[model samples]
Target: MALSTNRSPQDTLKIAQVRSANVDGTWAIANKAGIAYSHDPVLGVSVVSKSDWGRLAEELSSSEFKMVKIDSVAASYGALQVWSVQTPRFDNARAQRRHSGLGAIWAVYSDEKSSVPDIQDFTEPVDAVYTWVDSSDPDWQTSYSQFKNSVPAAGSHPTSRDIARYTSRDELKYSLRSLEMNMPWIRQIYLVTAGQTPKWLDTSNTKIKVIDHAEIFESPEDCLPTFNSHAIETQISRISGLSEHFIYVNDDIFFGRPMSPNVFFTGSGSVKYSLAKAHYAEASNPRLAVNLAAKLNAELIEAKYGKTTARKFKHVAHPQRRSIHKLINKAFSAEVQETAKHKFRHVNDVSVPSALAHYVAAAEGVGVPADIDYAYVDLGGNHLPMNLYRLVRGRGMQMFCLNEVASVSENEKRGQLAKRVLDDLFPYKSSFEK
Candidate 1:
């Protein structure tokens, strides 16, 4: 990864918007932050009917509107629910189903990727999709079928879908190949997984490196597996590949719509913010670990209580505000917190790798008060305990750019009610084509 020499402070004054229809709460948070957010009603409609999503797929395949998939939204759809009761008009109400004026604003502007006529042109309202890049074939539907045959036994694994749903080799290969060929905005690619590898990877160009359970840590739990698989491993592997400070992307992320890398890069001490997702409250740790050596400005220093002259110092002088705890948390782990404090407080100049090492040391039962600095951070939804702890500790506050997209269940038909509502937000590109 190439580091960006154009490190300028991000412009906080600019009016940035994100498309996050499935995550109404995230949109509400963005609105509170004064950022405009839109969500694809089409996705909502599709969740309510598959035919709608099929229509969207048809339009995208035709390149009608320079479509892009709002993948993060799709990834989070399982946790969201459309209330049966009519949603009341309230500022705090979720963007997905509310019926007030602001809700109307969201409804009018949000749209499926293929319906926005100027989506291909960034000069218009900004639009984008996330993708997991790799070098493989463009069509993996065949692999999707093969994956069904290879699923493990049901007793060992508990999933909503049969094991066959995940064993799609063709789909994985096709998706990875698209990443290799289409996404030019990327500077580096990191593949994080504890699952099976896609067969396409065997023959494709190695632009992206894969980091599975074996490569990242000794065990999944030790690695805090509940956190985003890509977030931890990619952050570690791609730190060295920081070509102009690259962006972290998920496997499903794809830019079917038009937008530029400039959308994410703003010359601010690299933009950092939690991505849009479901949120919940958890116990917060005030004494969480921040950069120490960067905090102390010295290479070596004796611990406040220990006899050691000086521990090994690491990294440059800069305070990072993020924490590993933000990634995972255990409700009643005060001992863990004490241990983290001992390590982070006393350690000198901790780099990301060194920090991981420290965590390893603490995990191995070599610390006190049970790591006080190991407080829980938010992980959106999913494994609440895991997200409550591990965090993506970083140098400063993060900036965000969202695409108001919707997430649909795998079994749900796409683009019926959600698409109709989305059409109300943005006219179909066919209007312009006509």
Candidate 2:
């Protein structure tokens, strides 16, 4: 049922900046000028001038405003985490602070007329790449044992250790399907692992290729059997026949909405990176390596560009260019070389391939920071799987990541929940599937 606003169409429409809201809830309704508004249940949100209201009363004796309900608020209330659109996480208004390092310089580069023309098409071939490994693999375990005994950095917290890190959610297959269905602009997908391939993928599909880590390491004898993601990411640029531009994503990340190439790269060829802000606080998450990576990103950007550096990045797909990789390797040859030797994560290690790539690109004038639409959910907590369903059905995200769920002898409930969520999100098999 529509509630009465008693405002005439002529008078309401005459007021250029009108506001409207639900008379029952906080949801903002439509304004007369096609702008947004909210109608308060107790105190109506719409405000019109006296002249307009009098004219409205004369023109239309009875006019009522209908309530708009996007969804039930209870839908997103997680056990602890909320996935509602009302949450600041999904909106750009919550994007981390402005880029502090080389931000101004990059802004100039981005605005330069010569850097990128307005009409350029960014459809040049780009590859999608991921590095994956299941720790349960006997060969992987053997290699891990060899490194664990020799390297002091092989430390793993007993309480925090979970198979969730390497556990396969079958999202890799779905991610491939998403590319095939949503992002046709992608040229190929390279799943990098230790000679392991998902059984369900259609390898015969010429567009997809499985890259073994042995093929990219500079010194196979030293870097082979590596457990550090930073070390492995550093070598991905060396893949043979890889395109000049590529996107790196983890197995858990999936495309939620159809997107185009232009989202990651500007018409002028500058790569876009979404910078996330981190506040000053003691490192608390059990994931110490992530915090170390952010600090390293800040240090490197500050040293070269001489400004405060943004310490965090949105957990999303990474846009990478081969040329920047080469430049960083050459500039930080010794540090990178030493990092490759660390079989496991170390406190001193720099995130050269992950966060550092964006900082380096911006400093060199080849990239600009951009805020993209995406969602992130940590299923390790008690979040309802319905959050996943709602995010897609009401897709405000181009991509989203599912994190932290694993099975064990005692508790398989979380893993089961994750499986159900994935099935619900993408039930149909894509053409890329066997």
Best by lDDT: 2
Which ranges in model 2 have alpha carbons more than 4 Å from their true place?
Answer: 1-120, 154-164, 280-287, 405-410
* Per-residue lDDT value at 373 in model 1: 14
Candidate 1 Cα errors over 4 Å, as ranges:
1-182, 202-204, 218-244, 272-434
Residue range 1-434, candidate 1, lDDT tens digits = 11122332111110011111223433333345444333433222123123333343343334321222232222122312221111121112232221111111211222332333222221111111122322233333334334334433232112212322222212223223223222233434555544334443542435455554345442333333221222242233223333333344423222222112223322232222221121111114212133332233122112222222123322111111122322212321232232222211222223232233223223333211111111222112244333311211221111111111223334232323323322222111210011
Give lDDT for model 2: 0.57
Residue 396 Cα positional deviation in candidate 1, in Å, after optimal superposition: 32
Would you list the clashing residue pairs of candidate 2?
Answer: 20-37, 20-38, 21-38, 21-39, 22-39, 29-37
TM-score of each: 0.28, 0.68
Over 1-434, each residue of candidate 2 has an lDDT whose tens digit, in order, gives 13224553222321111121111112222133233322212111122233333333232223322112111111111111111111111112311111000000001111112322226446467888888886767877777677666666344323222334566657677666555534545777888988777777778978778898899989889877777777788888899999989998887777654355666776666789877666423456625676766676676667767865645677788888889989888877776776676667666566765678888888888888887777777676555466665664553356777776434335567667666665544444554566
lDDT score for residue 268 of model 2: 63
